[model samples]
Target: MPRVGLFITCVNDALFPETPKAVVTILERLGYDVDFPAAQTCCGQMHANSGYKKDAAKLARNFEAVFDPYDAIVTPSGSCAAMARDQCPHLTGSTIGRRVYELSEFLLDVAGVEDVGARFPHTVTYHPTCHGTRALGLGDKPIRLLRAVAGIELIDLPAAEQCCGFGGTFALKNSEVSSAMLADKCRHATDTGAEYLAAADNSCLTHIGGGISRLGRTPGAAKAPRPVHYAEILASTA
Candidate 1:
């Protein structure tokens, strides 16, 4: 068992702490020794992605210092993982950059295992975010794991590769355009009649989940698919 550190990104740490918790549960079940470095800060992704190169560089240096000691750095957010693997090397070096991995990529490629003995009896439709889809190129890894879950009914999301309109600050900078894109993704998710809509990135889940509930409100809106992190689903046994 290699020493592993969990990089609970700013969004997951602040808004969706349960995501990191679930990551711990799944890894522990697989006999992994997971560490959460207290000194760990945001991977400077928010700063870099928002065009603050100086700030991003500073935080990127800190990221290498805190995580370099570990054998592996795993994160639930594909976007955050991308920042570490794709951006940090230019700021720092290849030291820690080569060690970072998006959750599913680590599970399927590094760990060399697909089924984690998870069981969840619910219909689920997955939305692959831009980073996991384009940056990470995590095609079908998430879907492969979902299919292996004991009782999961995984359905295909229409326009599955389309963006969920939450590109971190992109949502804030282009609210109207973001909302329009979200509407299409949510419509496709709801049309599947799945109980929950899941994604590798919680930020995307937050956006599309909100749209499912808030789009086209009337006196009484119909039931919409719930938004949940696929990791949480993968961590389940019932």
Candidate 2:
């Protein structure tokens, strides 16, 4: 078994801690040794997206320095994995970027295990975040894993390839456009009649979930689909 380091991104560490916990649970069950490097910090995605390239470069270098020793660095966030894989090389001029793997990619490609023995009896729909779909090219890796789960009804998300409009700082700087995109994404998610909406990146989930909640509270609005991180659903049983 390879020594895998879990790179829990800033948002997951601070806001969605359970997502990483789920990654650990599922990986451990698959018989890999997973380690969380306490020295790990932000991937500097926010800084880079917010036009602080120098600061983002510094943090990217910091990320490489911290996780370079591990056999493989696995992260639950596709956006962070995309950053390390796509941007870290330009920042550090190092090939450590190649070692980073997003959660589903690691399981399906690296670990080579699919039926992870998880069972979640819910009608779930998956949202492929922009980074996961376009940047990482994680096509159907998440869907494949979700399909193998014993009791999950994984439904197709309309416009599954569209952005959730939570491009790190993109949401805050372009609130009107971001909200419009998010509303459209939420409508598709709810249209699936899925009890839960799953995606690899919690940042996107946070944005779409907020919209779902708002819609739920609106007058004459139907129940909105609840957003859940894919890892959380994979970590569940029964």
Candidate 3:
């Protein structure tokens, strides 16, 4: 058995901790030894995306030093994994970069199993995050896995490939534009009448959930679905 290290990105570690916890639950059930390196830090995604190359490189080097020993590195985030796998080596200028697998691809490709014996009884509409769709090109790995889960009704999200407008610092730099984009994303999500809007990335979830929460308070607005990470649903049984 290869020793797997769980890279719980900063956003997940701080705001949405359950996603990583659920990642652990699923991997353990799949018979993998999951280790949390206490020395792990940010993958410099936010810094690099925000145009801080030097700072991002520093973090990338630190990440390499900390996680170099693991045979496989798994993360519940697509953007962060994209950073470590695709961008980190270039940022650090070394062959020291280890392949970082996002949750869905790790399960479908590496683990080679779509059904993790999970059972999620809910109408879930999946939102493919920008990085997961374009950068990582996750394709239907997430959907295929979700479809195999017992008792899960997966709905096709309208304009599913559209961005949720949470591009890390992009939201902070362009607040008004981000809000408008988020409005469209939220409207489409609620239109599905699904109980949950699931995605691999929680940064988008945080943005979408906040938008839905605000919109739900609109006069005569219908009930809105909750934002959930797909890993949480996958970790669910019965």
Highest-lDDT candidate: 3
- The regions of model 1 sitting more than 4 angstroms off are none
Candidate 3, number of clashes: 0
On a 0 to 1 TM-score scale, where does candidate 2 land against the true structure? 0.97
List TM-score per model, in order. 0.96, 0.97, 0.97
Per residue, candidate 2 scores C-alpha lDDT tens digits across 1-238 of: 7779999999988999999999999999988888888999898888887888999999988898899888899999888998898887877787886889999989989889888899999999999988998999999999999999888898898998889887878888899999999989989998898999999999999999889998898898877778899899899996
Better of 1 and 3 by lDDT: 3
By lDDT, rank the candidates, best first: 3, 2, 1
- Candidate 2 deviant stretches above 4 angstroms: none
Report per-prediction Cα RMSD to one decimal.
1.3, 0.9, 1.0
> Candidate 3 versus the native: TM-score?
0.97
Candidate 2, run of 10 with poorest lDDT:
88-97
- Which residue pairs in model 3 clash with each other? none
lDDT of 2 at 189: 90
Deviation from native of the Cα of residue 7 in model 2, angstroms: 0.2
